[model samples]
Target: MDEKRSVRISKTLSRVLRHDPASIGITLDEAGWVPVQTLLTALGRKGTRITRDELDHVVAVNNKKRFAYSEDGSAIRASQGHSVAVDLGLAAAVPPAVLYHGTTGAHLDAIFREGLRPMSRQDVHLSADTETAVRVGSRHGRPVVLTVDAAALHAAGHEFRISANGVWLTDAVPPGHLGRLAR
Candidate 1:
């Protein structure tokens, strides 16, 4: 499939699998998985016809590694970035000394004051590298990267998880633990 079509399908999959499965008349299980066949049927019904091979290709080649299949290949789910409540089943892990968060210039003031909250999602998504954070920030607008004192936060009793896609996950980052990296 072409990049445009693959991206469109990937976005739709993100919506249904992460944010609103109900929009497609389906539901994710507690761990955020749904039967692969069920997902295909629902997508077809919603006027987005996708074959199994296309779905496989999308999961295989998405740049961000946004989706995953079950161990037995029966189900699939978004690796992270869920708006709705769903346990990703990720274990708490030790993060590096630092991490990064990316956001637009518009949110910097509030972020500096309030720190980084998950907002609508379950956890504040973080990146291990500045470049990845910059790309994430670019999606919103003019990018700004923030350095997070992950080691300090962890020492202070905060928890961290590494998602399947390598995005760091945490409940929030207090202002004390954050510093501006680039604007």
Candidate 2:
């Protein structure tokens, strides 16, 4: 598929898998997975009409690696960023001493004051690398990077998990554990 078409399909997939499966009349299991065929059928019912090959292509080429196929290739799920209630079944993992979160300047004051909350998602999304964080921030506006003291958070009994797409997940980041990362 061409780039624009691929991107459009990817966005639709993200909307369905990460945010609103019910919008298309499909329900994700507790672990946020739906049978591949069921998702395809639901998409068709919604008039999206994505084919198996097209779905495969979109999943394969999504820049963020947002979607993941089951080990047997019969199921699919978003790697993270679910707005509805569904555990992603990701195991806890130790994060590095530091991780990064990217956001627009508009949210900086609030973020520093209230700490980083999930907002609409399940967990505070973080990135192990500054580059990914910056890219994520750039989406909203002028990007600002915040270095997170992951080690401190972990030591404080906060669990961390790395998603299939490499995003770091934590319940929240306290203000004391965050610092502006000069970029």
Candidate 3:
């Protein structure tokens, strides 16, 4: 699959698997998994026919590693970035001393005042490294990377969980735990 087709499929998968399974008439289970065939059928019904080969290809080469197949290879789900309510089943783990968030300057004043809120998503998504944070932030506009005091937050009893794709997930980053990093 070309990058364009792969990306299109990925966005579709991200939508149904993460944010809107009901939009395609499929129901994700408690853990946000749906049988792979069911998803293909649902997409087909919606006139976005993606083949199994294309699906597998997109899942394999997605740059962000956004989707995952179940251990038994019968089902699939988004690794993170869900706006809908579905527990990812990630456990609290000690994060490194620092984490990073990427955002546009338009949100900086609010972010500096309110810290990082999840916004539309379930948990605030953070990158384990600055490069990834820059890429994430650039998606919105000119990127600004914010340094997170992960260790201090963890010590203070804030929970941290690493996603399957290495994104750090947390309920919120209070202003005290945030620091300006770079534009």
Each prediction's TM-score versus the true structure = 0.98, 0.98, 0.98
Best by lDDT: 1
- Point out where model 3 deviates above 4 Å: none
Model 1 residue runs over 4 Å out of place are none
Clashing pairs in 1: none
Cα lDDT for residue 32, model 2? 92
* Tens-digit lDDT string for candidate 3 (127-174): 989999999989999999999999999999999999899999999999
Candidate lDDT values, in order: 0.95, 0.93, 0.92
lDDT of 3 at 3: 82
**Location of the lowest summed lDDT over 10 successive residues in candidate 1:** 174-183
lDDT at 123 for candidate 1?
97
Q: What is the C-alpha RMSD of each candidate to the true structure, in Å?
A: 0.9, 0.8, 0.8
1-183: candidate 2 lDDT, tens digit per residue: 899989989899889988998899999999999999999998898788889999899888888999999999999999999998888878999999999999999998999899999999999999999999999999999999999999999999999999999999999999999999876
Per-residue CA lDDT of model 1 for 1-183, tens digit only, reads 899999999999988998999998998999999999999999999899999999999999999999999999999999999999999889999999999998888998899899999999999999999999999999989898999999999999999999999999999999999998944
For each of the candidates, give the backbone clash count: 0, 0, 0
lDDT at 22 for candidate 1? Answer: 97
